[model samples]
Target chain A: MKFRMNPVYKKELKISVRTVRMAMIILGYNAVLALIGLLSFYFTFNYSFNNNIDYSGILQIYLILAVIEFGLVLFVVPAFTASAISGEREKQTLEILLTTKLKPSQIIFGKLLSSISSTLLLVFSSLPILAIVFSIGGIRLFDLIQLMLFCVTTAIFVGSIGIFFSTCFKKTVPSTVFTYGSIILLVIGTLAIIAVSYMIGVRNYDNLYSASSTMIEYNPPGVGHAINLLLINPAVSLLALLSKQFGSPSYLSSLLSHYGKTNTVIFDHWYAISILIQMLLAVVLLCISVRTLDPLKNKK
Target chain B: MLEIQGLYKHYGKFTALNGLNLELKKGELFGFVGPNGAGKTTTMKIVSGLLNADAGDVFVDGINIRKDKKKLKEKIGYMPDFFGVYDNLKVVEYMEFYASIYGIEGKPAKKLIYELLELVNLSECAGNYVDGLSRGMKQRLCLARCLIHDPELLILDEPASGLDPRARFEMKEILRNLNHKGKTIIISSHILPELSQMCSTIGIIQKGTMVLKGTVEEIMQQMNVSNPLLIQVVEGQDKVISLLKRNPFVENIAIKGSNYSIGFKGNKVEEANLLHSLIENDIRISSFFRQEGTLESLFIQITKEEEGEKIEV
Candidate 1:
């Protein structure tokens, strides 16, 4: 079959990208990235740095810049995607769209693609500055590629979540708030659960050692499961990637390695696993979003 | 041709369509007249494939909508009552967008878009932003968008709902032209006189069911109400009144100046016999003609009957 782009995606992109608002957003985004890069350079120069050009310092700047860019993407992607369907409904264009021959899945995917593509533009624009880390010898080209992939995957994941909420709610404000609320719950809730479980493990070990009254060492049961839980947390995955890149043991990796030799497949390769989890979440949310959009499928 | 059989739809606890059945033949201008919340829009949505009936089937050109919506959608063009336009798209681009939605693109899509815009009398505003167009112009643009695919059946839901008199007239002219071109149209409107003037057939729905249907003459006959015949006499008004009263077919004779307005319930032969009796009585009649039953009266009569039935139930 001959392939065709979703008409909605084409039209939305044509209208959105041609707007003054999108131009201002791009200008504002690049300015912020440049400011962050300059600030990182100034801080690196003034703080403890070698007399020669320090590659590790540059790597730190790269990581900080990447995090800031990711933060901006997370903030902006939901605002766009969360309003995709609800905005159509509010503007009264959804009924016309529904009467067309386009399938629900095509509509959902088109909305998602347009939302993430804008964020990807921002991510790709910051790549030249990110390439400065390549010359520093610590961060390789493959690391930058992996980081860009992670950024894109994260955008798709978050964009799909916003679309899912957009399909569920009637108004854009509520859908947007719910999308952000879900991200917050995923990030903080996962970390909070891990912290509570760790405390419980430490307390239980203390109790067990006291009852035995012998110098017996204790390792928490199901530490691998706990590490698997952290795999879904993007912050933890970023931390693990940064530590691996700099060849320095950060707190995230130290925590994982502190536990005994359990199968830490996810923890050892946390970056890849985090991306896979994000992809899985994106697929699930997109499926649900398409289903919600299809009235017939919704009933049956 | 389109056929909707035993269509039923429910929104939560309320029933929107209950065993509703309707059919439209080729080249027909089918006017769907109904009051608010009478399931006109619900049925339109189902036929457009934007909604699914709870228990029924919609067939366009003998292809079941449920079995092959993708193929069926190509044969139907739907214009909603309140559709929105894109913010920055030009009128021509707006047409092109919907044309592309129906799988027509590139140069052929461009040519088709221009033809549709010309059909809707929007050729002058083709280059202007869609958002900049007036409400009537925007409505016309939406109509143009609907015809971009050249579908055989056009389903227009309240196409002239918020239009001014001039705009309504223009829209009517456009629809009349489209109907003249042999396209089947299903139009829902509360403006019964407009429908009476244009539609070849009409179906009035009330309480989620078809209360009255068929051609205007057929519905007038089905209503079973007496036709009001007005007779004017140059000099024998009293004689005419006496003669009309004596006639068995005439009732409720009322006087307006030198004219007599009486309720005549009989067919053409009986009306001719009554007229012959009036002439033989030496009543010099200046004029005598029967008023045709209007769609407005028929709609009111049918809905009143529906209300009576509901109260009895």
Candidate 2:
């Protein structure tokens, strides 16, 4: 059989593209990245020229732009997707769509794809600004591709979260609010858990040492398995990726060493592992949203 | 083209449908009638694959809903009582979107959309934004959207609930034309007269069950039995009254001056025989005919009886 575009995705894209909102979004998004990129480049070049320092510091501008773009993805993806399903309900169009031949999975996947596409549009439109770093010969094509892939995966992850909440709530306001809330938990909440566990481990080590009469071999307590929770945190994944690309593989390791021993293969491939974990989580969320969208599933 | 047997649906302690059995043949314009809170909409939703019945089976075009839902949806087109249109989408684009949902696209979709737009008298407004259209136009567009896939069964819930007389007339005409084209349709409405005129079969649902189902004429005949027979006599009023009292089908009689209203429960032949007997008794009859009963009256009577309340009719 020939391939066909998902009807919901096609329709959403058609409607979204026709609105001035999309143009404004693209314009505003690119303007911010360009403004920040130009300023950072000017300052870095000016500072290096004045102090007679190495021009290699200009590469920091690429890292700064990637971070800002990643932050935008986290912030804007949920807003794009949180209203997807709930807006249909609010407009009273869901019932009609539910009656069509389209499956619940198709509807959910289409909504998620449309949201990711919109976010990707913003990301791709900013590539020119990001390419300014390429002129300095510091960032490679592979690095840019990796960053783009990371942004796409992160958008899918956050967009799935928004779509899941959209199916759960009837109104877009609560869905958007809960999506951001969940993102915050994934970002800051994982770090907080690691901090709390490390503190407990250190406290136990201190009590054990204080009770000893003589000096014993030092075995500093570590956070143990709690470090694995960061696999689902996109911020940690970005930090790992950037740290490696910034020519300091030891930076992420030293950062992880503060909480625990970091000699595992998972830590070595933390970026890939985190992205995989987040994609898996996105699939699970998308499945749940599909189930929730199925009106017949509510049967007694 | 549609059959539902022993379908039951409940919302907590409230039962929306309880053992409701209904059937519609090919090309039937079935008018599903009931008072508020009846199972009309629920049954429509269940048949349209929008809701699952707790118990019983619904078969459309001989295909069971539970066994193959996708096939069932392909055979059904459902228009809800209330709907909304996308703001930025043109009428043609909206139709095309729904068409694509059924896997029809490109040239075929465009051709079907224009034809459907013409069918709904919306050909001129095809380029207009859907949200800019009036409510009647939107309803028409929705109806057109439902037909894009050419489903055999069309389930419309209150398709003309909030329309002006002209729009209602236009909708009725469109539905009539569709029915004449041999499409099986199940429609529910508060407008009984229109349903009576447009529908070939009528089903009156009460509570969760079908209290009555038959042709429009059959139901009208059934309700007409309870209608009062008016007798206007210029002479021998006492004799006419005595003769009516002696009849077995005469339930009650009310007199107003020269006009006598007799609640006669009888068929056409029985009614005619009684009129003949009265004429044979040397009664001067100026006029003698049964009062015409409306579908609204039958609906009220059936619903009232189900509620165990006394009905004045």
Candidate 3:
């Protein structure tokens, strides 16, 4: 094989190699949580619902504990990427690397991809725990695929935010703090938007709900519609999915068939719009980083 | 060859360089001397392309730096005033990184890296992390990295700043050897003595401009100091300055107890004639020679009374 001459990427990859050992610790935590998720679902396998232990309560207990695992994934993925650039500036190594013949795009991409590799590892480690949920019944293969898609899109969105903030600040402490703060706000912001929209819709159209009867639509505000929550916020999406499966009494058995149909448009809207917005923002933000890394040209 | 014509740089209202013109041929070491903020560093940065010049052209091997920076960059090596080493990178890797930047690789690259390590005298420390090396070693390694592309011109900014006497000597020797090999070198140094040893000519800058530019001897001629007469006698050598001060041409005289050096007021002939008269008084004048002007003395003489005004480099 012919040896290629590439200094900037070679050095970046070497530096990434040393720091990526720090990645194992991130994956290790996910592994531990996934094992716990597996055991919890296993113990709920043959449980009775004759007394007060209904199927809805059984799934609720497991879902709450499982949401915590996804939360850890979201929190650490940004943290891994937040310091990638600022750390180089702190050590005084970035300038020398910039002097090389390597283009600025190569440098920024190498850093972004390095962090993504670690994020991918943590995302995949949760698979074993998720498989146990399959045995609980009513889980679709399409839903599982949609959940993984949601994890990747959201991580990419958060990872790009982390990379951008890291370059925006000089010191690592301030950069990392703002990145974490932004991640928390992003999560809350999504939930808040849905809640506000639902309240307004209910008040405007009284037909949507009534005093003596229930509307056919079961709209859960602050969460995605059944399909959207499945694809975008898979945890909440899955909760809405499981809610339909185990609820209701013997007297009204036939009402359960129509649960998944309500508010399906929310997924249709967010899926296309979120992917487009996230991708456009990621490309634009990284272009700024390329300019940031240009030593002589960018500063003036 | 490196040629700079009509170079000018401004930071806000402050102009660092104005209409600066210089030419450096291969095998010549040009010393850049200046007081604080004299634009010596600014000019070097422009030539090296670390900082852009507001006006003018820098051509390395006849390729315009502005028009074709990558091509020009291939022929010029720049060592900034301050630099750093990466963590977990060894000396060999550091050299390899730069070598690869120049697009050299495989057996040829490994061979070049080995030779460069030896050239910088860091061969033994090839496996050691760069941060483990001393400041002087790092500076040498930086120079070595600059040479990885076999650049024709070298722009070194304060190459020996903050080094001990021994380390400074080592740096000086390394630079001298590179200059001896027909490399065009532009060196900015605060230590005038270092420049004195190796520089063929110098430009002294004061307050963002080059005030004095010439050979060492030419700058000495501009000084109003009297011609120095070195009186080596068979007998009483110390009495030369004392006896000469009373004469017409002498100013600021220093007596060496038994031997002395007096600043002569006029031309070489005038001082020699004065000494001739002293010999008639049986003072026994055997040998007399004019005191040579060192770069350090000339640097002080030009910049001292200028009152820190901005000058063009």
Over B8-31, each residue of candidate 2 has an lDDT whose tens digit, in order, gives 999899999989888889999999
* DockQ value of candidate 1: 0.64
Report the error of model 1 at residue B95, Å. 1.5
The runs of at least 3 residues in candidate 3 whose Cα sits more than 4 Å from the true structure, single-residue gaps closed, are A1-9, A16-27, A46-74, A124-155, A190-269, B215-262, B265-283, B307-313
Residues A244-287, model 1: lDDT tens digits: 77677465666665542335565567777778888898999999
Residue B89 of model 3 has an lDDT of: 86
Model 3, span A1-300: residue lDDT tens: 766634555676676556757567656765676667655554554465454334443354345534554565577767866887887788665655565556667667767766665665566666655655565544455555555665665567677777888777777888889988876655665445555555555565455455427446654332224323223332333343334333423211221112223243443243455565666777887888777766667754
Best by the lDDT measure: 2
The digit string of per-residue lDDT tens for model 2 on A161-197 reads: 9999999999999999999999999999998989898
> Considering summed lDDT, which 10 consecutive residues are worst modelled in model 2 chain B?
B304-313
Clashes of 3: 8
User: Against the hidden reference, what TM-scores do the models get?
Assistant: 0.92, 0.96, 0.76
lDDT of 2 at A214: 98
Q: Judged by DockQ cut-offs, is candidate 2 incorrect, acceptable, medium or high? A: medium
List, for all models, the DockQ compared with the true complex.
0.64, 0.77, 0.35
Q: List the residue pairs that clash in candidate 1.
A: none
Candidate 1 chain B least-lDDT 10 residues: B304-313
